[model samples]
Target chain A: MLDRIRIVLIGTSHPGNIGAAARAMKTMGLSQLAVVAPRCDPRDGEAFARSSGAEDILEAMQQFETLEAAVTDCTLVVGASARSRTLPWPLCSPRELSASLPGELSGSDTGLALVFGREDVGLSNSELQRCHRHVHIPTSEHYSSLNLAAAVQVLAYECRQAWLTTTPVTSPEPFGVEWDNPLASHADTERLFEHLERTLINIGFHDPDNPRQLMARLRRLLLRSRMDSMELNILRGILTRIERHGDPNGNDHPR
Target chain B: MLDRIRIVLIGTSHPGNIGAAARAMKTMGLSQLAVVAPRCDPRDGEAFARSSGAEDILEAMQQFETLEAAVTDCTLVVGASARSRTLPWPLCSPRELSASLPGELSGSDTGLALVFGREDVGLSNSELQRCHRHVHIPTSEHYSSLNLAAAVQVLAYECRQAWLTTTPVTSPEPFGVEWDNPLASHADTERLFEHLERTLINIGFHDPDNPRQLMARLRRLLLRSRMDSMELNILRGILTRIERHGDPNGNDHPR
Candidate 1:
């Protein structure tokens, strides 16, 4: 699992940050680093000084011309971003992201790319949209500025923890604790959400005419819980049961 | 709750670390700083340079000869340490520490003091014992060395999160410089310092070329101490009286 994780830094402004980031990644046993259009030389003196003996990682760094180029080969691409956009994307806490990783990396040669943005503005719109998910590091609301390397260190630390432990059948069980089954995948979860939303509208529970933020909020809630295959099946069965009574043409005679 | 969080630096060898720590604390709305037997002058140019805009915190800093004295009034003293001693004290990860804070600071006249030790070796065994709890920020196991300022920033960030969510019951007025008055703004504080430096110089108490960093250090100390408007007026009044006594023509009373 460790070998499958890639750290991608995009449009990094400082050479020192690249060096520090390399050091941060290496400390957690992560060696794969891809730099996309960095503003400074990765092997500069400041970078070496900040690496504090982890210069080997910097020496082996791979350079890319664009964010798309960096994560093109990875199956799972995650953006480390704190910003929210007009259209909501799937978001994961570091723990949740960690818990999901072992399951994703279990059988495939496919890799996971953890992408960080420039020190200032973070990932561009298209870059963030390219990610499979976004991870937010909880910090103070007023003083939310975390150093770039520190952010990498935190996410890498979480990945290391998850790599050392078994993936819970449901998301976020106690560390080192295992379950009998694996959680449903993102694709499966989205299908379940669509099924649930359609059933809710059929039953007159959710009004499409004045649809506020119901489905989006449900997506947020269920995605955080991370249901297993059994949980998903049970939920879908209930939705199917309710579907028989609430179809547009099912009412024989209106009372 | 912000007022109740006190930051203590014990035997800190560099003045720059103190300034950086002050800046970190102020960004998260914490103001109290206590320095215990620091080896370097707290008023040095390095401190001012690193403090950024948080010199108010440095100005208000309290000096102590011993760790015990520094935390005498604190109901809960927590030490930020990376190394463990022969016997383990009650230890908390940073997340656990954040979860426990809201319960501790609410409805209490007492305060909590977070103590950080020397840059190289962490707190002495006795000093660690002085704390009610020990918090360790989870970092890379291989290269777990975090800068002093960064550690402080991480902890302060957590405290700020806790503060924003909790209900306000009481203000931490007793610990501040003056009761029943809010702290003077940075602009007001700067004016007060100007008033002070001019008076001290006019009284011939401060030499021009050999002035050393007395004024600069004093700015750091008083700013961090967070004196209120009333306290500012009282301090200026004292300086006014001292100037009258030190005037060159005041000693000609036929003696």
Candidate 2:
């Protein structure tokens, strides 16, 4: 998967970021490198100095005249940009981008390219539009600007983590005491809500005719609390018993 | 818990970062903010401008002369740093630090403090020592230097998640599935070894007169797996059944 992914740098002014990006890619087991009209020579002494023994990546770098040329053979193109644009293309965080890569590129001959923009001004709206997806690295709202290499490093690292930690079963059960079987179900919740509404009206805490807003808010709060089945059953049982004792009319409750 | 958590920024150079940190804290439902010898005025126009409606956090912020003064009442202090030091103090990742915090500060009068360092050099060795624990955010080796407020946001978010998700239980079960009973108990493990030793001697797997090396290796393997009670009982039951079927003395009749 790493070999199938190519990192494309567009109009990069700093040769050091080119080298750093190579180093970042190599550290995460990625080697394919593409540079599009770099302002400085990638093979320059400064670039090699910052490459930090990642000369193999620098040596194998491919130069292209345009972003489209670099991504010509690529099936899935992800543009790295912090700025949000008016375009309706899918926007992804770095974590989201990493997660989406493997399935998009698996067993396919087409290359997957992650395109980064210029240092001073990031990818223009038109340039970002050429790619299928845009990825943003979340930073502080005060100073969201991230150096090109730093952004590349974050993306590459997340990609490697996503690949290495792919498991047959990824999600863990909810963190708490797990019962062999739930003591209650969705039907129980509805029954409890109705009982609670009656109780609230009896206690004068709710207006009988227009009580939807308060009940909805209470339901949301309970849902967010993540009550286990047994707990829900206990609360519902209490409410049902209360309703039984305090009926104003001689009408039996609906099943 | 949020009120108890005092976010102390030491020698913060950027007013914008201070404001951003406040915003991060507020978003995570933390309110206590402390500034230690900030280089820029926290009330500056730029700071308020960048705060983006988190002006209340800045308005309520406390200014301190020193880091120690800021954290004097704190019972648990966590210092954030990307760099590892030669110090002998306990070091934890952000996850570990988050796990340890809830019990240490909650329900007690003790204050909890999260100290962030200077934007450029980060916390000096002396300043870092004042903290009871240190946290490192996992980042790419290529460029591990994270923006000050970005680091703050990550840590605050993690801390809030930890606090919100903690279930108040007298005894929480270990991670993994909820078993009917543990695979092995502490006492079962101790007894299993004794039974195994006697069986080994009867079968001549261990010398009755002199035995140490082989037994030591076997003990090491058993301890390494952290065998639980149920597993030990099953193994012992199997061993006993095997012994009854086969005897070293070659007895023809059942004893």
Candidate 3:
């Protein structure tokens, strides 16, 4: 389960921070690292220098062009951000986020991605929308400038602490008792959002030209529900049926 | 209470670590930082650069020649160490340490010193002996080389989390139901240890030549009890009486 927990850094400016983040992750027993369109070259010598003995994690790190690509396979995607966001999103402390992991990642195939944003500017609104939940580390009101690697270190430490104390269930318990379906991956959730959006637009219920946080609200609602694979299929099937019913030249191909 | 939590680094070789540590402390609302026998100049350019915006903390940092001098005023002294020691000591996780802080720092005069040792080699046996309790951050078994600043970040983060969640008590409450005396400071505890050791030697109960682990065991016992000032005075008076009774050339000085 620790191996399944990935630390993803997006648009990181400093290679040293990348290296230090790797070191931090390794110290917490998290080996999977992914980078999404980093501003600095993560393979720079400074990265290895800062990595100390965690060069193995750096060497084995996975790089992607976008956050969606980075966390497409992850079942749970959490973004680390400051508390000054104007957008109302699901916010939780690192401790709360970690406490939910035992149940969240109970399935063998269920993986989690802890996403960190750029040093100067945090996750953009679109990038944040992709995350299932946002984690805010409570810093001082006087000084809230937490360094990039330091943020990673704090969250990774929480995850490790939670992992150490939790006893792993030998049999996979799917959140609720006797539920057999695997949790929906990021890709699965994203596809559902797209289908829902298109169906809404076709039915004239949502106007894409003058979108007023409608999709964002729906995304929040669905993400909070944490739909399993079977639930996702049912929702997508409903979306397809709606599209067929609303569209003038639509053929019903829903399974 | 946060300001009273002093982060003490002993024999830190890297100025960058000192700067990063200051940044970490500031993020967690901790302002007091003390360094004992640092190998590198904490005011070096690297430290300031690493501090980012927390230079004020670095500028206001205190320096000391010894750990004793650093934490003499503190009521609680906790050392951060790895778990490979042959000697038995009271060990706790970062969470457990934070959980104890509410009651521990309830007094107006009570302060805590979180001691971190050298980067390469952690706290020495003598340094460990000075601490009332040792905190061990659970890290990966394969790579336990946690960066000094990262360690600071984790502990500081925990302290902040504890602070944020706990409601402050309007009035200070003693540990016991009706205990009126304040907790003993590190200086007071040190004096008690010295007096206890001398009395033991005088009474022929403990030999200085073959000291073994007698002092360490006694220190652990006294530290665990968390004696109040009045309790400390009573114990010291008892030791003085024992010395007078056991010593050949002792003068009677009754308190």
Top TM-score model: 3
lDDT, candidate 1, A1-255, per-residue tens: 788899999988888888878877876778899999998887789988878778778888899998767766665778898776664556666767887777666634447889999888998866775565688876545554566776787777778767767544344342234533454554555568779778666544567888675565455334434455566665565455445323323342112
Tell me the tens digit of each residue's lDDT in model 2 across B1-255.
557888889999989878867766766667789999999897888877756667888999999998767876665667887776543334565555667556554433456788999988899876765555567766555545465665676677567656765777332222223334333433455567778777655433457578644444344334334344455655575346434434423232133
Q: Of models 2 and 3, which has the larger TM-score?
A: 3
Best-first order by DockQ: 3, 1, 2
The window of 10 residues in a row where model 1 chain A has the poorest summed lDDT is A246-255
Model 1 residue runs over 4 Å out of place are A1-4, A26-31, A93-111, A157-255, B14-31, B41-63, B157-255
lDDT by residue for model 1 (B1-255), tens: 889999999888888878878877876788899999998998688997778667888999999999989988888899998987789899987667877888887756778899998888878998999888999866666667666776787678678757755755344342311234555888888888888778655534446678776576456446544565666665565455444433334442111
Q: Which ten residues in a row have the lowest lDDT in candidate 1 chain B?
A: B246-255
| Root-mean-square deviation of candidate 2 | 21.4
User: Which pairs clash in model 2?
Assistant: B183-B228, B183-B229, B183-B230, B183-B231, B184-B228, B184-B229, B184-B230, B185-B229
Model 2's DockQ score: 0.02
Off by over 4 Å in 2: A26-29, A108-111, A167-255, B1-255
Best by lDDT: 3
- Reference-based lDDT, residue B199, model 1: 63
Ranking by lDDT: 3, 1, 2
State TM-scores per candidate.
0.59, 0.44, 0.80
| lDDT score of residue A139 within candidate 1 | 58
